[model samples]
Target: MFVVSAPSGAGKTSLCRELIDSIPDLRQSISFTTRNIRDGEQDGVDYFFTQTDSFQRMIAEQLLAEYAEVHGNYYGTSLETLNTAEAEGVDLLLDIDCQGAAQLKKNYRRGVFIFILPPDFAELKKRLYNRGTDHEDVIQRRLENAEQELLQAPWYDYLVINDDFQSAKKKLMAIITAERCRMSRTTYLLNNFTVKGDK
Candidate 1:
């Protein structure tokens, strides 16, 4: 499992998309959210949009692995989805905020935690403004929240700075490739090898 968190306008979604497209046997985990579906987002693809009652019920039933309220909307990862991925021996990529990432650190400690940071505050502010998706007030709030999120980068297993799009994508891909080769992650390969190191 891989958990990636970043501040707004850090290009995390774009990086994840590129990584998943190039890597086979890797799947992005679509989260469950109470927020309304945005333009160009599919229900099961981007997020499982749900009402507050259903989301609360899911929480009450202990169906979520990790959950958090961000920007007044609830978002969560389902335990069922994680179990399915594990059973099928498929890797998972999670694109979430720092709040949800912190919850994942405690509930899903085995995942590769990656933090994506903007190159600098000036660039970050520029990206946020150019995106024009949020209001000025909301953008300011996001900037403030981003400052706090960046401070949490030290707790992650890996940190990637998004200075250039292609370079950052390559770094993200490298992290995934290296992680897949870890002794703990590739234990199944040991089953095919003898004690003498012969297959």
Candidate 2:
């Protein structure tokens, strides 16, 4: 499993979409949330929209692998989703926030955690304002949250900065490719190439 996390307006979603589309066997784990759906967002697609009570119940039942409340709403990934992907030998890509990623890492030892950041604080602020989706107060809150999130970069397995879209995408793709090609996972290929007349 791979966890890709970043603050709002950091281009994580766009990068994730490109990664999923490009990778042949990658599956994105859809998260469930109690947050209200924003414009153009659909239930079961953007998120498995549910109520706070239901979310809490799932947590109590230990059905969720990790859960957290953000911006006054709850969000989590179901264990069933993770297990299904693992059973099928599919790479699971989780696009979650830093807190959720940390929670997942605690339980899943083999997960690859990648934290994406914007080019710089100035650019990050500009991107947030350009989105025009939040009021000044809300934007300020997001900026504050972003600063904290950025500080957690060292906790991730890899840190990717969105300085250039294509360059960052290439770096992300290379990382996934390199991981898949690890010696332990690709031993079969090595065995197939041995010389027939070898001792």
Candidate 3:
């Protein structure tokens, strides 16, 4: 499992999208959201859009592995989704906010956690405006929230500075591949060979 978090407009989602396309074995765990779908987003592909009441029911039923309220809307990752992926021996990439990431970190200590950052605040502001997806006031709010979000980056296991899209994507893929080859995860390979009698 891998968990990724970044402030609004930091390109984490775009990076994760590319990573999914490049890695066939990895799957994105689509989150459930109470927010309205954006222009290019699909129902289940982008998010499982649901009513606030329905999201509340999920919270009450303890069906979500981790959830948080951001910009007045609720977003959650279902426990069922995580369990199913694990049962099938699949890798899952979770795109979530800091709050959800914190909860996941505590519960899934072994999962790789990464934080993405823009080259600087000015670039982040430029990207947000260029995207043209939010109002000026909303962008301001996100900028304010981003300051706080950046403070949470140090605790993450890896930090990917997204100065260039392709470089960042390559680094992200490298992180996943490196983690898969960690000694702890690969020590079982030693069991395949018997010790030779060298005297």
Candidate 4:
């Protein structure tokens, strides 16, 4: 599994979309959220929109691998989805916030953790304004939150600075490719090899 986290207005979402579309077998892990569905978002595709009661039940049942409350809404990843992906030998890409990513780290350490940063604070602020999805106060809050989230970058395995869209996309793709090609992960190939030297 690949867990990616970025501050608001950062390009992690767009970058992840590029990866899943271009790479066969790389599936996105659509999370469950209590937030209302936004324009252009589809249920079960972007997120599994649920009632707060149902979301609380998932937490009570321990069905969620990791969960967090962001912007007064609950977001979570289901352990069932993760288990099914692993059983099917398919990779999963998770686009979540730092809060959720931290919880996932304790539960699933094998995932590749990637942190996305904007080119600079000025650029981040500009992006937030251009998004026009949040209110002025909400945008300021996100800026404040971005400062805190940036501090968590060192904890991730990869730090990707999203200066240029295509460049950042290529870098993420490279990271995923390298992780998938790790010798330990591809040891299944050894089963087909007949070696002359024995350990």
Candidate 5:
């Protein structure tokens, strides 16, 4: 499992999409949320949109691997989905915030955690304002939250800077590739390649 956390407007979603599409045997874990489905978002596709009451019920029943409330909305990952992916030996990509990533690390120590950052604070703010969906007050709040989130970047296994979309994407792909070829994960292949020289 790989947990990716980034502040809003950091290009985390776009990077995750490219990573999942390029890597074999890797898929993004769709999270269930009680938040309203945004424009052009499809339920069960973008997210498993549910009511607050039902989301609370899932939490109470202990069906979620990790969950957190942010901005008055409940978001969580289903244990069943994650476990199934692990059983199939597929890498699970989690696009969550720092709060949820921290909680997940407590339980899933083997999971890889990656933090994505924007090129600079100026660019980050520009992207946020360009979105134009939030009011001035809301944008200010988000900026404050983003500053806090950036502080937690040192806690992640890797820090990726989105200076350029393509360059950042390649760097992320390299991280995943290197992880897949780690000694602990690919020991079987290493062992098979250790035979005495015949040629």
Candidate 6:
């Protein structure tokens, strides 16, 4: 499993989408949220939009793998989603916030945690404004939250500096591919390739 966390407007969503499109067996984990569904967003595609009461029910039932309240709305990843991915032996990608990422780390220690960073604060602000999706106050709030989010980068396993889209994508792909090639994950591939005939 892979957990990616970034402040808003860091292009993490685009990067995750591209990664899923490029990789054959990777699947993105759909999260449930109590926030309003934005325009052009499908209920199950972008997020599982639900009411606050429903989210509370989910929490009470222990149905969520990890959840957090961000900007006054609750967002959570269902345990069922991760279970399905593991059952199918497919790699899963989670586009989550810093709080969600931290909770996921506690529960899924083996997951590859990545922090996506914008080139700098100025670039981040530019991207936020260019998107033109939020109100002036909302944008400012996001920027302020971003500073605190960036501070948590050191807690992650890897950092992808999103200076350029292509370069950032390459770094993300490298991280995933490299993790797949690790001895721990590839032990089965080398099981029968020992120095058998060299004795």
Model 2's TM-score against the true structure: 0.93
Question: Model 3: how large is the Cα RMSD against the reference?
Answer: 1.8
Q: Please, what are the lDDT tens digits per residue for candidate 5 over residues 31-125?
A: 99999999999998889999999999999999999999998999999999899999998999999988889989998868899999898899989
Give the alpha carbon lDDT tens digit for every residue of 1-199 in model 2: 8899898888999999999999988998999999889999999888999998999999999999998888789999999999999899999999998889889889878888999989889998999999998899988998999988888889899989999999999989988998898877788987766866756
Q: Candidate 5 has which clashing residue pairs, if any?
A: none
Candidate 6 on 126-199: residue-level lDDT in tens? Answer: 99999998999999999999999988889999989999999999999999999999888988887687758867
Q: What is the C-alpha lDDT of each candidate?
A: 0.91, 0.90, 0.93, 0.92, 0.91, 0.93
Angstrom error at residue 91, model 4: 0.2
State every prediction's TM-score relative to the real structure.
Answer: 0.94, 0.93, 0.94, 0.94, 0.94, 0.95
In model 4, the worst 10-residue window by lDDT is 190-199
Error of 1 at 96 (Å): 0.9
Q: What lDDT tens digits, residue by residue, belong to model 1 across residues 34-88?
A: 9999899999999999999999999999999889897789999999989999999
In Å, residue 33's CA in model 2 sits off its true spot by: 0.1
Model 6 lowest lDDT segment of ten? 190-199
Model with the higher lDDT, candidate 5 or 6: 6
Report the candidate with higher lDDT, 3 versus 5. Answer: 3
Q: Better model by lDDT, 2 or 5?
A: 5
Clashes of each: 0, 0, 0, 0, 0, 0
User: What pairs collide in candidate 2?
Assistant: none
Model 2 segments more than 4 A misplaced: 188-199
Model 3 per-residue lDDT tens digits across residues 1-199:
8999998889998899999999867999999999999999999999999999999999999999999998789999999999999999889999998899999999886789999989999999999999998999999999999999988898899999999999999999999999999998889898867755673
Model 4, span 54-159: residue lDDT tens: 9999999999999999879999999998998999989999998888898888877688999998989999999999998889999999999998898888889999
| Model 1 TM-score, all chains together | 0.94
The CA root-mean-square deviation of candidate 1, after full C-alpha superposition on the true structure, stands at: 2.0
